[model samples]
Target: MKTLFILFFSIPLLSACSGGASKINGHPNIVYILADDMGYGDVSCFNENSQIHTTHMDRLADQGMIFTDAHSNSAVCTPTRYGVLTGRYAWRTRLKDGVLWSYDEHLIAPERMTVASLLKKKRYRTACIGKWHLGLDWEKDEEGRTLLTRPIKNGPNANGFDYFYGITASLDIPPYLYIENDRVTTVNIDTVEATSGKGFWRKGPIGDDFKHIEVLPRLTDKAVGFINTQSKQAEPFFLYFPLPAPHTPILPTNEFRGKSGTNTYGDFVLMVDDVVGQVMAALDQNGIKDNTLIIVTSDNGCSPLADYNELAEFGHDPSYIFRGHKADIFEGGHRVPFIARWPAKITAGSETDEIICLTDLMATCAAIVGVDLPDNAGEDSYNMLPVLMGEKIAHPIREATVHHSVNGSFSIRQGKWKLEFCPGSGGWSPPTPEVARQENLPPIQLYNLVEDIGETNNLTQQNQQIVENLTALMKKYISDGRSTPGSAQKNEGETPLMMD
Candidate 1:
């Protein structure tokens, strides 16, 4: 009787041990999908009045927590990407004034920590699979023929990405061709020509096989292919899929065109939705859906072309009642769509309004993997895992959030109050002849976001005390290299005064 009893207990113990082993080996796969120049209202989940339906993106929101008050650190692509990878504001870097060109050298310094590098230390397979607009040193000769320069350095590969397949800059920009690691897939400068195709830019070496209209579909195909290929590998992977759709040249695939009644921009958004669906399908096909975390967001708000008077007549408000688009230091310019889904960790159909930034992604991933960032790394990132899991209530992750405009204007947000350093709209509007004539406006602007989501009211004169307090906070953050995690850098010169 005693032997039989002991045998029964041993059987259960063996089963328990097997289950524990499986659990120990299971690490969640992570995929971060970032869109370029997509607005808060562009996604149907966030904008009720959006004429177009982003079914896949909306489904993603339904499966995870939707962040209503999320924002990008900068109002443009390159800066926002820098913050996303390094978890530090782009303004702190030497290239503080503007973004880089296609031929520009690597923007990310080798010493700087990146999301891919940090994850690599923890044994994660990292790959950047889409638009890499952060800049890289393209191989070129004096004759202008693309040559094999020293192995591509100081870019994604040097920054910790195990594999990279993308472009050096926006689709409309020059040197238009797919870059696979250190070499261009198809190089031909002789056949290159400058064309004014829709919103296309001039002077680029485009491949003969490449067309401005096919970029979005091609990028989507590459992203889906990468996910499938990486899933077969032994190590769990982290895929940074920054899509090039809905940004410029608004070229949706023929099948997707005219599908949305809104216009070309709307059609482009639909293509983006299809891309999301393809990614999700790939994850499921690989049998890793249950163990993968997928996040979808934008680099910043929509562009002014979506707001050009003719486009606006169709009843599309890219900013969706927010003050400005793309380059302004306002809510419409910086606020963006953020959705994260992890079937095992985050509850489906959840939502949160806590203010968060793309810069926080590095810290959040670090916290999930049970790692701590060194002082120099992720100096601006705040871990949002608790908030994401619906475990925290009312506790704010950030005390203040900083914003940068296209023309290098600055703004700081603390709680509901926001302060902008420049007077007129800090982007294309400022240098315009008509806006320059408006002498009644102050040189600085302040708004209470809680009361003025549209930013129609500027209270710089009425609220002197709030302005002083927020301005001091903003100045301190600017003088310091980062606002949250690291020590402040000592100002070498006289600090800029806090404007009222």
Candidate 2:
């Protein structure tokens, strides 16, 4: 009887120990791929009438969870990226208006916590490959002349990325050269004139050997090479690939050009799809597909140029049912594609409509690593790991999310209510633009997103109670430095306006 009792208890305890010693089944390698200026309707998985078939991107959605009402923190590249990295609103920072230029100083302060820095603490090898629109300090010559040859400072290397190979700003911007770590891979001393080369944006200095047409392919190649090199290492890796495609000067490579019947923009989108495919293939080749968490999303909505003659001519509506594009406070401006694929964790062919923001990545990563975030870090990020795993149903992760426009306009979403502080579209059509001030428009705009996803009807007049409630929520969010997770910090400027 004594032997039997000991054997039974010992057997259960040994099993528990064995299970605890085994590797966590769900811990995954994360790959975040960010698309610049990609629209909600750009992918066929999201839009039924999308002219281009993004097979790889579609496959990702099919195999993973697709978020229907996802958003970036801003409608522009730099702010959105800043929010993603810091898990806080970009408007809270000194860069309250506009984006950082290529020659500008580093946007992310050295002291600020970052997703890369957080991941590095967990022993993850982090790398950022592709367009780094977030500003970096480039080295200058003795005469205060900007030298393309000198190494830069306060870039990804300073921000916690073990390796970084990319550009300072948009591909069209000056100091047009590929930066690897702290130095430029290719330098140009002569002032190169901007030209409409292969339908890409023309500006600043570019090497004669640099082909505007091959930007996507080049970035894709670099990403694949990095993955190949890291696969041999023992540490888990994180790759933050921000692609500069389908943005301005849309230039699809020769192979993808004319393939999508939807014109140049559509063709460029197809090229982006190919890039996704290549990255997926690389993961498979390295036998880490099951353990990797690949997330593909965009910085913001489709640009206004995509809505002009090009969209009408090709029967493509980049914003889909949303009212405005890119810089607007409307859903079309900030709502974007968010797809996550983790074969070992997330369920296949699942879709989650829970409102999520790019800002949550930092907290989610922290949760994955079993690391608790300090109060100052990821103030806005809420861990969505439970939602991603399809576990929690009614328990929402984020209570409210704040969005920023190119012109520094602010909008806040809480539950079903969306509150925009400005009257007319505040961004691309600034007060100077023709559509800036609508004669009869109200000072504030409020919409019940649950009832009106298109934002066709303004509820500021009818729903005074909701407007007041959402306004207070927005104010509390902004005043306090964070929206979802941390305590409210007071706003320093004029008291935030309320519609009601």
Candidate 3:
């Protein structure tokens, strides 16, 4: 493992590397702010009639490029997070369906190259702060209880990040203790019961200092401190700021409570917006705003726990015009508001409908630092640096994008067409797989997304050839163990991680 001091000492020599338009100062610092369970319609810029005005997020969009077609690789947290870090789809791994439990072992293979590891290769100091749902291997007692006594094995620190500070999983999950680096911030834990309704969470152990309402603010403060600490350093830093906000335990501070005038969920979103503002402010206060490449997006769509019906009563729809919420094989399930700002390269207030996935972070960063990725790494990543630089691309950057539902349903999108293998929503939404089957729906579904973005109409019967083509492409992606242009690589497991 090469240290930053060793690699960064030769920055002048490395600047000779080609590909990106690197500045004399150095490669731009990258700050990836990932919001958990925030929906496309939650942000005012993405949703015209949105009730919660995400002022900071909207300003970020105003200063950078807003990707209208950006999507998470999966409609869930763990898998989508895996894709973001590893630049590979999580479904290809053994944990086929659903999310990882708090007690589950760490997911990323030890040898895998992650965004943090790659950035560190370029002498960029990497740190991850906030929720890491990708699993952590914890020590256990003879009674089979989790013990956060020592440094976690194969945790974030082991996977490329120089520093790690955050919870193990969603706020709603149990054992609500903060982990800074590999050790617990505090060992004082008490059993806490699950809360019902909007502020819902499973019953679990919680540290004395861990308050549901304070988690968001604590994480934000930590991020600001990190930025302040890095301000004096010449070397650029990479902060993977993943927020566990507006997700669950919908705990909004008193100052933001009732701010949205909609509901607790709406208030929580406003708080999330405040978090973005705080991060941006930190950058500005530290004089790192202009050169920093700030990209903000969500892990997945809004969870139904947001109470859509209640939001509808306030004339606010979290999913916006899209059909379903999270965990479904619909546009809303995966499509998210992706905003990036980099004054050095990206045009201000620019917007592109260029289709992109979170997995692209790896290759884009690699391109920025002028590192050509080996075939084995970033298998599903596509470089959108050109699109970010206002380049007029003649063809789509991706041959087609793949989406996965919580139930492991597969959907492939190319241009305007989207095909799903499951019979229905394939998740929590109505017309579930069972319902669709009972209603005699076809085993597969095809939609012309361009003509019918809502996906209300099924064109499977009329477009057999298109369906076949997409199916074949999906199969090739599976058999070849990758979607991007590369030599055939084997998947981690025997199961194909897809439906016909």
Best candidate according to lDDT: 3
Give the residue spans of candidate 2 off by over 4 A: 1-27, 141-143, 196-200, 429-440, 487-500
lDDT of each: 0.73, 0.74, 0.83
Ranking by lDDT: 3, 2, 1
Where in model 3 is the C-alpha error above 4 Å?
1-25, 497-500
Inter-residue clash pairs, candidate 1? 423-443
Model 1 misses residue 51 by how many Å? 0.3
lDDT per residue for candidate 3 within 1-500, as digits (tens), equals 00000001112223423222233457666777888888999989999999888888888888888889988999988999899999999888987779998889989999999989988887788999988888889988899876766668888998999999999888889879999998888868888888998788999888888888888899889988987887557777778888888888888989998999999999988988888888888777765565567778888889998999999999899889998889998988999888878776789998898899888888887887889989899999999889987988999999999999988899999989999988889888989877887898878888887889999888989999998999999999989989999898888777453454
Q: How close to the true structure is residue 35 of candidate 2, measured as C-alpha lDDT?
A: 85
- lDDT preference between candidates 1 and 2, better one: 2
Give each model a TM-score. 0.90, 0.90, 0.94
* RMSD, one per candidate, in order: 8.5, 8.6, 4.9
lDDT of 1 by residue, 421-477 (tens): 777666654432136336655667789889998777889989999989988888777
116-165 per-residue lDDT for model 2 (tens digits):
99878767678988788778776676888676777788999999899998
Candidate 1, lDDT over the whole model: 0.73
Best by TM-score: 3
